[model samples]
Target: MKGKALFLFWTLLIGFIFSTNGTLVYALESPNTDNYQKDSSYFFIQYNGEEKEVIVNGNITLKLTGWADDSKTTVNGNITSVDSSNSTEDITLKVNEELNELPLNETEIINYRIIVADIFKSEIVTTQELTDSSTIVVQNNNGTSIEEVKTVDEYDTVIENKGLIYYSSGQSGEKLVITKEKYDSLNIVKDTTTIESNAVSEVKATPTTKSIKEVQPLTRFSKSSTPATTTTVANKVPSITYSTHIQKIGWQEAVRDGALSGTEGEAKRLEAIKISLENTPYSGGLTYTTHVQKYGWMSNVPAGSISGTTGEGKRVEAIQIKLTGEMATHYDVYYRVHAQTFGWLGWAKNGESSGTSGLAKRLEAIEIVLVKKGEQAPGSSERRYITPTSVVYTTHVQTYGWLQPVKDGAMSGTSGQAKRLEAIKINLENLPYSGGITYSTHVQSYGWINEVSNGQVSGTSGQAKRLEAIKINLTGDIAKYYDVYYRVHSQTFGWLGWAKNGMKAGTEGLGKRLEAIEIKLVLKGQSVSVSATQAFKEPLKVFLDPGHGGNDPGAVAGGYQEANINLAVANKAKALLVAQGYKVYMSRSDDTYVSLLDRSQKANDLKADLFISIHVNSTGSGTTSANGIESYFYEYNPDYPSKINEDMHNNSDRIKKSVTLTNLIQDNMIQYTGANDRGTDGSAFSVIREAAMPATLIELGFINNTNERQKLVTSSYQQKLAKAISDGVVEYFRIY
Candidate 1:
């Protein structure tokens, strides 16, 4: 137990030492033998691209780099020195920046126990009988006879003789011997053997043999009761070889027959690829194309040529592969890719697209295989390459302010409240291409503001300026594949005609405010059913009556007639409402006297939404001190003893709505004109009481007061009154 423990300890120590110095070793034990003898058997192997010989029991230091595994199947290093003495000296080597594992080919191995450097790894075996050959013998320190095996054909052979000896060595300089029975039991056949180091090449002589048969190199060994059987064929089997150029890493070593060539789980993009056919008897080759980033699908290229961009930092988003000529008839090429967001996608065959197209995703890894015609596929062949596109938007409204964003043809602002959209922001979602959505807005005071892109604000926020018109468009690949359509709900127009791809969407010079907007991103050549002509809503009809016009001159003071001042203010208010996209009607446009009952009848017949009678406050004598603005809405008073119409009596709903309108107009008139606030009250005026809709009477500053009448008669003060009344009407509709 102590001896075993000590052996284990020393073995571990030596392994640690070698590993620290970047050396890998695989050790196999040979059978024990008592007889010690010096043997002249040697191994012939390729060293530094040259064939060399190494004798048994010879010690050498080998310098190698890029060591991969215990088997050393893939190596990019070579032997730098050779020695015959049993000296314990450290060997040094240079390492490659990126070490890769590669498959082996022919011509890598020829005989037993030989280490080949800078070449693929393989082993050869043969089945033959030894006869009529010279035998060489040697004597060890004990003077015992050591029989030497003779060289046969270049291939390894299986002998039928008994009592044959096989020899091997270990680190402690111990010899291992294999008896004939053990050799036969091993059932050694033609198999692959990899040279692990740039060590001394040890070649054992092949015994003389007759009736020798050839076999292919072995890639892996498996246990069997008998030797592996092989049948001769007339043609070589066809195979596919491929390599990938990856991000950060350059082109990797090639792999064959459906082996993986690119990295998985590394987040590296496959930028380019080279694919070719090997060992094929057909006359034609393969062709492929790639969908690249920024530059869509590239042109087709022949096999072994690059089908995508390299060194430009572009990603391969998709690929299509197919065969040509006789090869196409004999086989079908199938492939799948590991995409950026989708992971391993379904297989694609015969030139169908394999990865995503417009999604702007990258290909990370890939696997390819060829099947004979009508053979079962490796996986499902359903193509999956779709990306959804949409537009999102938000609006700052007159009173509601910035509402939450809406998406894809949904309304972003208020609809029927007559609120103006003050500001806007827009963005595109899942737009699987380059560039972004850009938009420009025509504002009330600032026309055609510079364009803003992708969720940026395009209209005024806190300034209370309305977005009168807008233009939307896309850039780069987004423009190439998609069209942006938008329509607006203006104050009077309701919904205007649909505009597309940078066309004007709302009224520009007419000064109409956009109330609501709907935006959509449609694929090119697809039809979306949006209103292409004005889908007019019933406009908010307002009836404005200039009180006591024409035949009856209203209260006159300081040479200013109340009738003329009322007419001027009403006309100005009509013009302002018209610009705001409202439908305004006046009982007297040019001071033609209309009775109070006739005025209310005209407004009711028109089915107006609101009614306001413009007038001036008065005291019969010019000496009165009464001054300021006031408004009145009607409510029924049973004690008044005057017979009232049914629409005017006990109509609580109309009274409440009229009161709201009266207060709004009264407050705005005082605010704009800086007049004394006489506030609002309920009255039984004939025009307001008999009106069917919400009705109010607004009184300008007192006409009998010299100071107030002086200001009211001026054109500037009249214009201010018009603006105040129009704004109050707008505010009323915004709330109710």
Candidate 2:
């Protein structure tokens, strides 16, 4: 598989979404996939007035359209979305001429519900009739009744000689209208008509019955009359009822992230809704993520909305308003729509507000805008609102994500250290703002760059324009040059900044453009790179020193020998590392006595990069309860220079990795062999103090603790103990 010309894909967080040839990437880069912030998503069907109320059942045909983010691919999954703003209505005229049935008034509707049994909740997506909110009919005792319906956009019906017994398949308050001409078999002998109204009717009888019976089909838009009519299916949980109204219309809140919509909590049960909605994602059909930040949840907020009863929907029994200017270092607001008014709402920070009681004296909406990477939109660090506009109007719009498309080419540097500066120039040829991947050289850990199209030599090129930065002290290993990514959009679609390295999958074309820039180098001979990766070729070697020896026991614990344990465990690990081609040497292979000086001599003789020593554990309490494993490195003590040198090894973060590995091993071993995790220790022991390379020593279990001592005496325990130590070594390196 080596020479197959494999493509190196590095698509990262949010921005492109293109799915082609059945190769779809389910996970699109969203702004906050990590923090769970998402872009827009959801498929929608544009409805005509006659098709508003659709009752879903068997034989339903469906086709829909949706949106995707800036990615070229996305994974397939259930679609989650709010109900569409527009709705359609379906009315049917079913009549038995012999029965002489009467028609319904224009403003009125008659309902005949049929409770179908054994309907599976999942099959609704495949069933055709179930997809349409309008078309619905229920089988009744005598004949089929009106099933379901919705108002096309907004409808105001004119009721005639009314006989309205509204029917609903499953939706709440939705209904379909029936006509008298359809049911002409029944006669109106009473002076007053049933469900009478001033609208058109299908019945040929003069208005007589004055009783107006109202039955809003469980799903129709408009006031409904009370009735005990209902349809219950077997073995199915009630389908969650949802509405297109602004208030809490569904069983759950839609957007549950602070930065995206400000509503916070566990990721909404989006997968459930997506399954219900025919695999369409809800948030405006966006495939990529938007951004991320630490967040809280609407875990306490129920999915339903309050009645705008003014004050005290602050749910719970108390109201606490906190207004402090001290916001957490990382805090973002989430958003959602209120069911009562269908308005947006969001989560707030613990300590951020207006005017001070000591803080700003007001509550504010949270809005943020960031231009996506690989895009030409001018990236805004944060959002700024027009102060003059009404504030409460946009409290927490559950409707949209704060996404701004790329506008133009941001600049880079002066083509200093880039491997192929020539490609940078070619990349800018047809770009709206010609700024040939302009970039300067960077020698420091921290750096900056300007927008390429805004390629000014000063402010836009250096540390001042570092659009994004990470905290890794990198010394340029795999990448030879930094290629900035640009986007294609309307007026401002062009260059942005250094291709956030590997931002999207199969980005060879972008890399090819980056390889085209030609730079003028005045080198007298060959190019001299400051990052000299070519300087060293020797393999890193490490000498393992299992502290103490035969004649001299390091630390007397219980009745066990620490020196014997150290050498035995170290030898087992030596075999493992050497098997993987790592050169290793041990201070003393046998139980024969050896001095600390001699151990360092062997390590220094081999020019090792690391030295590790093993030992046994014990406790001063001398109590049976006192037990556990402990790892020791050098202790940082300002009083001694050796202390500082060993502290250097302990503080390098490598030891922490060692400690974690040790703890895991000891914990597992303790569980299996009845030993205990005494935890790890980083201290300055003599072996740690004088090692030439980074070093550490580990203590197995306490022999002083009688229980552990007895356990240590068995060959089975010893072998398990040896395996644990070896495991810790391998984990510490994250290599073997």
Candidate 3:
């Protein structure tokens, strides 16, 4: 055939063979006329000079003749049935009387190397009328000759070697061989074409070229061939390659198959990932998603595309990977991650979630492999998916009122503003177990208040009271799984150290106020850097003097020794001050002689921050009507009562500070005891005048008054006075 004519013929034939809409149509001759049909269930094979249709579960017979070494041989095979239920869904031909199942589209040697069938979904044949003049004779290697008739238009590229003829179908590089019957069915007027001798031998000697698609030899046998050579299918093993966008390092070099794609034991994180298949035998690509830090699970992306974030510093926490289309049928994609805190987790396969979710963990390293269908997995698949709990809290601040809630170790109150935290509410979110968080607080005017649980207010709100200290604890099953950690910013002290599991987080005895707070929930067994004990502010030093102790009882009325009353009140006040985180020193802890000069000298030598000398007032014997509280500070008057030294003149700042301290103490005493206010005064008294720090002298009441004396000697009245004094000291420090 002429090259141009053959090319034109093939162009028209190829166009007619494949449909534009994807459905295949075959033009079959019914021994008389050419007709077309859309049949995918049947295929036709030429045997001798007859066209036979092979159907599923049907029977057929063929006498396959081939030549080797210049000799001719024939083999009879009866195909009893065809089964399509195998793993690959290829048709299995039950050939010969042995009922040997031979898969189609594969090379097999049945006494001779022959391709049983290269079945297409559709078949077609083009014919032309021919005369005896068009016939040609081809000679074989054995000097044997056969008359080949010009049947149909000659194929554009036909290789006739030995007895077999090879031709291209011109559709997707498919190869086909023309039998004598398939040509005879074209209604040629001349002699029929026939196979030459040594057909199989010539095919075996000829090496496959790029013009033809290579056919894999069949590995299965008919129980007759040499235990069947295993024909390894090319590119059968999937090539899975992946890259990770790591922390610090960007996208790393891609790794293939089951190689590690991230880090191991380095504590680095995988922030993003790109997975792809190279030279894979499947039709579709891979799809994957990642559980990312802050963002959670991201949407799935196709193969070779990024699944998480990059340049955001967020970690890929968990992952889900899957194969699509024919790839999913033949292989399973299995992956595992070395997570932050968790190390290497169990293998997850085919879209199952791997690594930890909800927990703020990073995927440190990852390994991925493609396993053939029904194969053993790489490792155990026992892992946890954690939904971390959140601790939410709110605080009520002085003047500003209750603030909005915050969660997960966030600060909930103001700082550096001198505003006090007055109340608090706390709760747990997404807790994976039963029970809750409970807390209590110490407030002004009230000691440790009642405990509150799970969002209930812990301290006084709306009342101008300050929260001094707090204790937080977890309860029930929640406590079993986690620990609660908390800390506070307090007045005078700044930020205190962390306290956990019901330990106090703020100041105790010191009248300091809580300014801000932070709370956190940690998983059990996880390490948290906590202080050995709650931090505290350096305590202020206070010097207390019980006036006229031992034999020096300055006032006595109603069987009450003034020295005994002063000692009792001073002791109670010291206890209260010490509890508030104050360092208190008394001139006399018990009944002992302490002169005014000795008291002032002791306070100065100790370098006390504040000095207060306790005394009882009297207007000589019958002053029963005079009763009240008065406080005195020192003011050096050179011309009035006594000579003022240079050191006394240099104490102007001390004198002003002393006046403020005296007024605070006197006002609190009057409020607590309901004593008449005798007001504050300045006097050149030795106790106040000679002290280095701020100093004050408090006259509790007229000791000669019968009613006041009765109250001063009692333990309850002394405690009231002590509380008032301690409160006044707290107010003084808060202002300073």
**How close is each model in CA RMSD to the real structure?**
25.8, 27.8, 30.8
> What range of 10 consecutive residues in model 2 has the weakest lDDT sum?
388-397
> Tens digits of per-residue lDDT for model 2 on 310-423?
100011111111111111121222112211111122321222221112110111112222221243322221211111100010000011211122222322222222222111
**Which candidate achieves the best TM-score against the true structure?**
3
**lDDT at 264, model 2:** 26
Model 3 residue 444 distance off true place after TM-score fit, in angstroms: 20
Ranking by TM-score: 3, 1, 2
Q: Which model scores highest in lDDT?
A: 1
My TM-score estimates for the predictions, one after another, are: 0.32, 0.27, 0.41
lDDT of 1 by residue, 61-128 (tens): 23334434433332333332234433333322222211111111121111122232333222222223
- Tens digits of per-residue lDDT for model 3, 1-736: 2433433443454333333223332221111111211111112221221123322221212222221221111123333333363222222232111111233323211111221221222122232221111111232221222332211111111121122332223356443445555544433315533432211110011122212222222111111223222343353566898888776455577798789989888777787887778666546667898997657677777765567864344578889999987779889999988887667777889999888776667888889999989889887877634468899999999888999999988898998899999999999988656899999998888988999999999998778999998989999988887899988998877888988898887776668899999999988776577773545444679999888878887788776788888888999999999887889999998888987778878887887899888888888887579889998988776654432224652377877788888888888999999999999998878777767788888998888988888788779988988888899899988877
Candidate order (lDDT): 1, 3, 2
Kindly report which residue stretches of model 1 are placed more than 4 angstroms away from their true locations once superposed: 1-235, 294-296, 384-724, 727-736
Which residue pairs show collisions in model 3?
163-196, 509-579, 509-580, 509-581, 510-580, 510-581
Lowest-scoring 10 consecutive residues by lDDT in candidate 3?
A: 197-206
